[model samples]
Target chain A: MDVLRITFLRIVYSALLLAAVVVLNFVMIHLAPGDVADTIAQSMGGADAEILAQIRADYGLDQPFIVQLGQYIWKVLHFDLGSSYYYNRPVTELILERLPATLLLVITAQTLALVIGVVTGVFSARRPNGFLSHLVTIVAFFGHAAPVFWTGILLLIAFSLQIHWFPVGGMRDVTVTGGFWAHSFDVARHMVLPVFTLSTTFLALYSRLCRASMMETLGSDYVRTAKAKGLPMRSVVYKHALKNALSPVITLAGLQFSAVISGAVLVETVFSWPGLGTLAFQVIVARDTPTILGILFFSALIVIAGNLLTDLVQRLVDPRVRTGQ
Target chain B: MSFLLKVENLRIELRMRAGVAPVIDDLSFELAHGESISFVGESGCGKSMTALAIMGLLPEGIGRVASGKIWFDGEDLVAASPARLRHIRGNKIGMIFQEPMTSLNPVYSVGEQIAEVLREHQGLSRKAAWAEAIELLDAVRIPNPETRATAYPFEMSGGQRQRVMIAIALACKPKILIADEPTTALDVTVQAQIFDLLRDLRRQTGTSLIMITHDMGAVAEMAERMIVMYAGRKAEEGPVDKVIAHARHPYTQGLISCVPHLVAHLTEERQDLNEVPGIVPGLAEFGQGRCLFASRCARATERCLTTRPEEIAFSDVHRSACWHAEGM
Candidate 1:
């Protein structure tokens, strides 16, 4: 009963928070220095005064700000995000088309980075002064410090031009017509640079976070108790220390999930990946208000879901949290 | 037959910021099967480190058994290989720790934690090991063992957690059990209950026990023999009753006096805390070629300050390491 109540409360709280985010996002995007009227006129090829008024009426841009916000909120309730100015399509449909690509890119990057980072962190923490530990530290520092776009461009120059080992841009070659597996293989070949570019900063952050948390957990009294129980060092570390160490890492992963999607704008631009990241850039450039708001709403939902999952996983892994102590 | 456990000239050293320093210097003792011994000392007196060294659980790259032999069941533990040590550790020698709150892993249920040791050491299947774990919890007298078996450490009280710690340590019925201040963090009532539980369990299992604690009362209640440790070295050792009656070392004298005996001092008066003067010296003063306790000893002389004391026997079983042992 308590679990059900808490979960219900959490969902209601999230819904309320998301509604506020909707209003806040609408206001903040409006506050930014961009004229939807001007963008529409420019795209419609220098519309005269009469045509400008008609464009405003067409996009509902001439409505009062309060009325527009209420109408937008009402449309959100009905799953109608209006239509993009440049694409001339429902904003939801446009976002959904790009959603799969962005999801693929972000999930692959997150999984790859997390696996590599956490494994490296565990090994590095096991032998603090070992060569692998030192190498990981140096690499993580550089990875975190370097810009994602710069990393992407560097990978493109080296792998695509210098070595000819990978595709330069886009997901799969347009000329390589093949079966499903073959096409996927080609797309994977092209994803190397963008995923690598997007994952570097997160990988570095997780490795450093896991390393520090592991070190602390390794020294905790429970770990010493495990060691004293005469269990092998392997069991002592992996079974006893790792789970406790991972809670903070899980939290960092949750926070990074949404940030990674936003950060993909930079890396996706460099690689010209046909993902939401690329569409996001184009929409912002075109001042496509509905598309921009749609992406923001979707990203906010993803962040909330990620955070909820992290909390649930933490409860599962940590008995203290599960029992509410 | 040889003693079930014996430590001869056991020395433990730590690599500190200054240099290598002895934390446990020239300590020796023997435990017959089913016998109980206690090492009583203040904090930083190396009681816990001695226990860790015996179990081969000393902190890696920092603390090590610098020299001497820890003979256990016809094996020299100090020279034992890693594989041999692991074979003996949880299988033949179990250990419980001080902090009940922090000793058990928060991620694991008490049952699973106990079952892990049993499975690892005894090679029992998961189902059998789990059954044995519930039995162990029941043996330790945890209420409703079936329900409590699935409960996490956070769900249990301090006394109950210490009981779980005992259950884990005693799961494999090791020949020797070392409990390092297992009940210190518990409340007074819980402390006595844990002590009673340990006494009942030991009586039943016949496991030779080495309890390391700073509480003289705990030593008096739990141990057959007691060794007074001061600054990493043995100050005095003998049968607990004999040593308590006639403590040869001044440090032991100070410790016993510090504990108030209510039966003898029945007057309702606000008594001052009778803590011993000064404190235990750090590792820097461990090998200073003088008695580590001489600074605090009321009977220190030129010889006491210039030379370290050696163990001088007062009886077949009792010994004290002080120049004035004979007089005292």
Candidate 2:
């Protein structure tokens, strides 16, 4: 019952957060120098004053800022994000078309990063001064220092350009004519580079965090007590220490969800993958305010959802959270 | 051979940045079946380190038994393999720590923590182990054993957590139980209760206890024999009542007088409380050629500063290591 109430409260909190995100995003997009009107006329090879006015009036840009904000909020409440001037399609439809690919990429990378980080972290924490642990620390240090896009370009150069082991860009072979398995294999091959690039920085962070957290937990009085209980070393480390250590990592992963989404924009643009990231990049260049606002809203929603999932998992794993204390 | 546990000329070394120091210096003691012994000393006097050494739970890469043997039921623990030692720990021997609050995994239910021991040592099914855990909680006198079984350590009071720790330590009914200042973190009243519970449990289970404590009152109450340790060496050893009444070593006497006797406090005018001055020597000062406690001993003589005092036998069970033991 307590968990239910807390989750319900979180949902309510998320709704308020989404509203703020929408308003803030709307205001910020308007604050930028160019809007859809300027981009449209510029694309038309510099329109006359009347043509510019017609374009502004046509897309409701001629309205007052307050009036535009109110209409936008009303449209958002009705599950509408206005129409994209550049794409000549509804913003919601465009986002929906791209959302699945981004979700697949982000979720896959996140899961891979978390799993690899935790395993490597546990190994490093076991013998903190060992050669392998030192190697992990060095690798993590390098991973942290390199930016995501830079890492992507490097991997792209090495794996795709030199070895030709994987595809250079996009999510799959355009001419694939096999069944689900073959298609999936092709997609998986294509994902290797982008996903690896996206996960590297986060993987480094999580592993380092988990390593530190696990080391501290291993030294905790309780872990000693567990060992004294004649438990096998395996049980002492994993069953007793890992759960406590993972708590902080899980929290960090949730908080970093927004960064990961932003990171996807860069990775997707670099790879030319058909995702919201690429859509976001194109829309921003075109100053598509409606599409930009739509993407921001969805990104905020995903991040909020990610945080909620983390909270629920924390409650499941730690009873202290369940009691709402 | 008849003793449940025996330590012969034990020397434990701690590796420090500067050098290695013998933290537990040539200590020897024994525990018979169902007997209780207490090691009384101030913090950093190696009382807890002795207990950790016995359980083979010493700080890794730092503390190690440099020499001597820990004989438990005819096995030399110092020579035991890690796997064998693990089997002996919590199965043949169990231990409770000083801080109960941090000595339990905060994420697990206390019952689950207790159950883990049963499952690990006894190889009981999960359900059976869980049931046994509830019984253990009840045995420790935790209220509402049924509901409390699912409560995490954070939900419990310090005293209650200590009880849970005791329950975990005693879960397998090991032949020996080493309690490292188990009640120090509790309130005085709660401390009494825990001691009573420990005594009752020891009596019921016939488990030999080695209680590590700094409290003279606790030593008097919980131990049949008491060893007063100073600077990692046994300063005095005897029956608790005999030593408390006729403390031979200056350090032992200081420990005894440090506690304010209730009867004396009630009967006489209050005067300045008696206290032992100075501190336990640092690691660098340990295992010197001369007596380690000489700098702090009021009865220190010129000889005491230059020569380490050997144990002077007073009886079969009583001994004092001090130059002035004959006069005292």
Against the native chain B, what TM-score does each candidate's chain B reach? 0.97, 0.97
lDDT (Cα, tens digit) per residue for candidate 1, span A173-198 = 98888799989999999888899999
Candidate 2: what lDDT?
0.91
Candidate of highest DockQ: 2
lDDT of 1: 0.90
As a whole number from 0 to 100, the lDDT of residue A280 in candidate 2 is: 89
Q: Estimate each model's TM-score.
A: 0.96, 0.98
- Residue A207, model 2: Cα distance from true site in angstroms: 1.0
Report how far residue A287 has shifted in candidate 2, in Å: 1.8
> Across residues A185-263, which tens digit of lDDT does each residue of candidate 2 receive?
9999989899999998899999999999999999999999998988889999999999999999999999988888999
lDDT of 1 by residue, B109-209 (tens): 89999999988888999999999999999999999999999998888899999999999888889899999998889899999999999999999999999
